[model samples]
Target chain A: MFAGLSAFPLTPLRNDEVDEVAYAGLIERLVAAGVDSITALGSTGAYPYLTTDERRRVARVALEHAGSVPVVVGVGALRTSQVIGLARDAADAGASGVLLAPMSYQPLTDDDVFGLYEDVAAAVPLPVIVYDNPGTTHFEFSDALYARIAQLPNIASIKIPGVPAEPDAARARVEQIRSAVSDRVTIGISGDASAARGLNAGCDTWYSVIGGTLPEAALAICRAARSGDAAAAMAESDRLQPLWDLFAEHGGSFRVIAAIAELGGLVTPNSLPLPVRGLDRTARDRVARVVRELGLIPPA
Target chain B: MFAGLSAFPLTPLRNDEVDEVAYAGLIERLVAAGVDSITALGSTGAYPYLTTDERRRVARVALEHAGSVPVVVGVGALRTSQVIGLARDAADAGASGVLLAPMSYQPLTDDDVFGLYEDVAAAVPLPVIVYDNPGTTHFEFSDALYARIAQLPNIASIKIPGVPAEPDAARARVEQIRSAVSDRVTIGISGDASAARGLNAGCDTWYSVIGGTLPEAALAICRAARSGDAAAAMAESDRLQPLWDLFAEHGGSFRVIAAIAELGGLVTPNSLPLPVRGLDRTARDRVARVVRELGLIPPA
Candidate 1:
């Protein structure tokens, strides 16, 4: 289920609406790069921003462009019913699975958290990947809680965001859960900065932000890591280190998708939802410089 | 703007759907208790968990029950577009204003944060109240950025969650912003525990989760505070101290909502979103005891 690199592409927007044509082009590029799966309507895709119809349109365009590639759609929402509806829409749009984040609102009890997943899992027929990004949810999944969720029939994987400060602690937590759940649940590592470490810790999948913009390089790294070619994987990772550094330098995960979109020429002066300021000239130039160094853009 | 107590009533659910009848009843209680305003679809109302239709229905029901009392609707969403849609719906539903939380993503840049508020402020015709609950969003609004956002037309107020580790720092920042922006943006403090502290910090409004269930007592506390009856406010606050303690004992915001719902007879056997472990019997009993102490339930 997790052999090749999967890309979560950013959803392009125009006039405060989904830009389907641009989104199709981005999806085609990733599929052409031999990506194993493509995720749409993810945080990268600004899933929450899109209208229900707009989200469906994006999903339709993405699935169409992806052709035979597995399309995983993000189905996170504040309400369980909305999530269920999104899950249905994703499945109808021909998605292979859905990734779910914890319901937002601080300090959700373990029961409420579990109930949300159960409601979504039961509502959608597709396999569901539980996304545990405590950074966004402000509530981390305890190992004991994750283990209980892993036992659910339709839950296929867990997406854990990599922690730069204590990579080992995160890795150990993932490994512990993986062992507890055994083959029933696969672990997917988010945060390309710690992909190598996560993979070494038995993460079955790696969802790369950089990969969405540069699938070839991301895939190569994944292939190397999978084949136990540590040197090759590290080298590829190092080559892309500048881009990762750019993501870190420009406010980490928050701006990474927009930065990638700017580099890929998918959108002009990429924007985020209100209250998110745009990157300055200096920040944009830094990204451009790294993109050129990585041969992401032709040297000029 | 910041002179009175505002209550966010629980949006009751029945069999996995919005229970509009119960919702109206809840709002009626709050209105009867002399609450200055009612906030619908706020985090306590489980705004994120309800479907759009459910949210609309609840808002309509609440507005109807609230009569001419100003109704502020929470329109926070991960996407700017969605927030705009919600703002439109809230306006149509007769809400007097909108309460918006920042986007739910990790490591949001200052630009993203600013963009979120700006977009929402621009989208809704009604005045917008920025909800700055970093405890849930994991993205705090910096003083510099909040100052800029406060300057946006239609940006009327800010709802600062009471649980920040450094409430004084937030207060200082708000004061600084207010000095720069004039009274264009009023400040509202969330969390019943810190309502008095927020008032002392020069906040314009006090919002209460406990008020969802204990409207009479909550409004009494607010009236006392607003009338400069510090002694009475403190006495009323002390009487409701058990309610605040339930929040402390249950360990988070959502739990407090669930506990209060049970005490109010608005819901039976309270539940929360999944992955969150349910409150244990001991915890539930603790909550029940507090409810009894508050005279929220008839003496056995």
Candidate 2:
């Protein structure tokens, strides 16, 4: 069911609690900006960090606020039982689909990975998206594993990483996955910097991070690629180069984007969890300048 | 307060719930084997996978069953607030110390790492053991970071990885940590294979995994090193060589040891969480053979 651009909204926090008001506003903005989907409890959402109660609350808020936009709730956990529990919670909260990742402290074999997805898919009525993020989960799925997982009932799509730093390799990798999986399972690419190249390689969707805070800018880039307008897509990607570069430099942009949202008066300050220090004054200024240049900040 | 060998007991599961009865029995075995300390919710206990209530129950059970043996509870989490919450819960359950690791889905800077420990230490009156396991947490601590963390008022000790596969390097690494931190803060080394080398390096404590399951064998190695008998330490380590080799081959012995514990009639079979598959029939047979040879199985 994943296609076009899906905005992964950051879970704004207040007083160590999920800021439902702020999250609702964020999702409303994504829907208003014409995003194809809104993903709550994603990596950007700090799904692992939040308690089970908070995840359910976030999903409810995102789904209620998302309205016309489909809301995909991330249901990844260390155990299949836990993931299935979260999947049921997501379905109960009225999420569009559940995104599952094989997250374990211990190494998992391909059979173990297959079994995890199979159990969750069987338990949940909602479509399940296999999130193949080896960088975080440390469990990479081979082509054979992907083919096997694709055969699971209710398996919807696969979200593959597109290393923005290596655009050519990113495109090739996405194309390889596109060829490996069944046609029914859509291939989506993450990593904002690789959006243009990945989409140009015919990836069906962009599971995006920056797209949450700057949906209009992200939508333009995705739309350009969807129409096979490589030049237009590259131009939009180029416009967002500074932000992508910042994300790479900092390891990730979850905190930086939260700071940006705060700076733009989108969310209250100190919305991120503890120890996730936002950009220092100088770096925040640089991000502000880039966001302003792209017309993302200052309330359009 | 950490000294000698601290056994990290695994949390046996039944029907996906923490089998407190089995856990208490495991703690009883560790105490009977004369382990110096018992860590209730350490990595081997699968603390991260358990729910907050389950962790609390496990901590209570370990402390109650541990009797005189000091119980240290692992309280690491992705959020500072959650870590502090766990620490408070640990203290209330009469845990001797709380183990804190800089766990994050996102890579953390040095400042971020220090801030996490400081906040948790200040918030909880209980002593906090800085757990530096980069392989799992993905957040490595430098000597400088260790020095900074040592300054926290309630910070008790640091549990650093001992790369059992490389004994020479492991000794050097433990020595470096000993020199970097103040003598007031104890230094405990984990990884069963590195116990003899780490203890030989004048490390204050051994935070052991296999020690919980096979405490007699682990305690023998620790006692040999503690008494300044290098030859005896290596001999004891050699006695358990097969098990260490299995751990190295399987990425970790968390599941392998779980299987061994079950085979020894310590816990019921299938105690490990799903996706964390135990050794197959053949591998289990091999582990069983090693356990039997070491006299770790066939409980007395």
Report iRMS values in order.
3.4, 1.4
lDDT of 1 by residue, B49-93 (tens): 666777788788888889768899988776666778889999998
Best by DockQ: 2
Off by over 4 Å in 1: A163-177, A200-202, A271-278, A298-300, B163-181, B200-202, B267-281, B298-300
B82-169 per-residue lDDT for model 2 (tens digits): 8888899999999988988787676788989998988888898988889988777878788999999998898889887874446677
Off by over 4 Å in 2: A163-172, A298-300, B163-173, B298-300
Task: Judge candidate 1 at residue B297 and give its lDDT.
Answer: 61
- As a whole number from 0 to 100, the lDDT of residue A6 in candidate 1 is 72
RMSD of each: 3.6, 1.9
Worst 10 residues of 2 chain B by lDDT: B162-171
User: In model 2, which residue pairs have backbone atoms overlapping below 3 Å?
Assistant: none
